[model samples]
Target: MRLEIRMSDLTVPEARDKRNSLASRTDVLDKVGVLATLPGDMHTTTEMVASFYGVDVELVRYHVKANREELDTDGYRVLTRSVFESEFGSLSNLDPRARTIALFPRRAVLRVGMLLRDSSVARRVRDYLLDSEQRIQSMNVEPLTGLEYALRLVDAEKRVLEAQARAEMGEKFKRAIEGGDGLTLREFHKKYFSAITETAFMEHLYSKGYLINQIGKGAVRTEGPKAGTRRDGTQHRHPTYKGKRFFYLHGGGIHGGKRREGTRVRPGHWELELRDQLAAEGLAANENTAGLFVIEGGNSKGLA
Candidate 1:
């Protein structure tokens, strides 16, 4: 059975509202300030910043760009510079007491002073911010304080891991195809998708068009006729070797049908077929598929 999934779309107004709310928050400003202190030439990008801040990249970029624009504005230039100097200076001096005092605006100097009198609480706050910045950097993404930025980093990391896993699976599948091994969908799942359900796993490959239909059920055929049509269908008949039946490809929704009299199931035939297919497709049989596998590699012809 096939199902169509729809993802909700966000409108410009909704996006703007979220951005405004994120920017007004003090925590966001602090994070942005810290990120600004880091070397600009570093490998960090908008995606990395989003991941570090746990915000969506789009949202993080919006706020960061807005913040940068604000900093460039004549009205905000002096205040922004002052904030940066104060934060960095306090951090460099290793004076948590002075840091707390410098954090507040001029109007709140008295209140800040009163809080500083309690040395322990002031130190805790300073330490918390510093520690937070460190944690953000370790993620290999630029740190931002905005809630949106934080959310982006979380999503980016998730995307990265997912991409890595898919790439690995695709490479394994490619090997199986080239090697002419007779691996069942179940066996493939045990090797790769053991953590996921069979139904979901099959659906994922089907949706990606990595596996195509053979006979009636889905099989490991690549680049063939569309469903309900057969004019351009590609079919493979397994060859017997070492008393085993081995097909060019395997590991789809379908397993081999019962053979005629005296024909026995071939063991490990499907795996060999997969390896051979990978070689034929110009992909290194031993290439690391981690996080880079995609159907067609963004080309018009799928799964290269």
Candidate 2:
């Protein structure tokens, strides 16, 4: 009773419909592997879905345009106003002014995997689906034992709870970084380099010649009315040229009669460098690393 499935040949209407019907079997996605997504929800942005399929976001948009009706029916949606804010507001990295954000649920992502013709990941997913369908057709309708049924339910419940926990932590980290130009040294250490205390991190910087206590030659003030001038003896520490690559002195405005001068770490470069450093020291697992999760491709343009 196994039917030949050409799920990847999206041009065939019968094939498209066949795959769309199978989209509900999102358990196959679990077999594919856990893709990085925003914590609480099972949705991913177009860019991330593209990354999962190993294709450019532009290619994803192209497929969306060609199959909008089918995709929309499969729970593809463009969120806006309060809905957008409610769903994605926690992602401080997203532009505050973004009026619309498109989200593809697990079903829609599975649909895309079926529709995509050029991606190797998509091809593999389609092959998996076809083989799975054939196997199901070939199997007898045996009733599951009570123990096996309970195990399945437990596994499903565990996945849901784990996803919820990850989502909460992801939102917390994003909130911690909001309203700031970049991460402070303390914040950076807390998030990415927690093995050592802030004091120890400062000492590491000093020992590595990245920071110095005394105002050396070419030292420039980076904050207050004296900013851009030679750094005075008043400042506590300054970053050397090498340190400046990852950390920068920021803020020069006077608030409450105090000249504010703070150091901030560059995000991407800092994370990469810190990860490498920790790995070299055999402490990579201790680093609180959040890999890229839900990156939306810029603006809704053709997607809307």
Candidate 3:
């Protein structure tokens, strides 16, 4: 005698609901030999998921986009803000400019496995899910106890403290930027965007036309040393007219008892405008922030 499930497609509500019920059963996942997760976090990345199912990353992303509502409801999340850097920053091959990272908890991975139609592994996983629905529902995950439970409690508290630290730092930077004439670009990045070097930020701005090379171009200096040189070639930086609104020419400051001209940015304006600019450049803001500031794009892998 043989028993079989006619439900080849897991997208149907009945099958989908069954998959959800079995999502948390790691013993079943181990029995099926699905992909392993990160060591400590027990989360899997898009690339790893795609590799496991023998499909391109694009296909995995397509499934994600198509079933986002269901997947997100299960456990899918896009990591943005400071939490990403504080948590997964050390992951290998991570692009420094990536402002958003897609993460799938174990349950979410199971959901994806069930939803994927093109992969053979997905087919088998879905079959097993439907075939063992009763068993999976009855399965009980082992509860933590003793030292393991104590360690988990400590880890949970540590995460809470880390979250609070990120919030405090953001608040501190906000207060600092909202004061007086605001911070110089270098100072601004140092206070809020410390992961990005001042040079890299300036170079990106220059390349994006937010800033222009002042020297070696037309417009000779009218005052100070080398006033007659048609091309002063002093490597002075200037914001284009479009980018000028975000900045104000800070009057020369006493440095080593000598004054120097500089520019300062209005952080609030700069932050919003820069996000729009990067969006035009094919970057994106996280959904939580997209409504607040970003103008376009979806999948982001750049400086926020």
The model with the greatest lDDT is: 2
Better of 2 and 3 by lDDT: 2
Per-residue lDDT for 1-304 in model 2, tens only?
2344343454356686787668887777767764545433467778778878888988999988988998898889988757866754445445577677778989889888888888877777777887877798898876889999999899999999999999997675564433245666665656556776677666776777656555444578799997888753554565564455566677768989988877666554354565565456544234346533211231111111
| TM-score versus the correct structure, for each prediction | 0.17, 0.46, 0.40
What does candidate 2 score in Cα RMSD to the true structure?
A: 12.7
The 10-residue segment with the lowest total lDDT in model 2: 295-304
RMSD values for the candidates in order, in angstroms, are: 25.5, 12.7, 16.4
**Candidate 2 has what TM-score?**
0.46
Candidate 3 per-residue C-alpha lDDT over 165-247 given as tens digits, one digit per residue, 9 for 90 to 100: 99997775554334355456665444344565677677767776656666467667687897866773343565554455565
**TM-score, ranked from best to worst:** 2, 3, 1
**Model 1 regions lying over 4 Å from their true place:** 1-63, 66-188, 192-200, 204-304
Model 1, 44-76: lDDT tens digits are 233333433444646544543444433232122
The lDDT of model 2 is 0.67
Model 1: lDDT to the true structure:
0.36
Q: Score each candidate by Cα lDDT.
A: 0.36, 0.67, 0.64
Cα deviation of 12 in candidate 2 (Å)? 3.3
Best by TM-score: 2
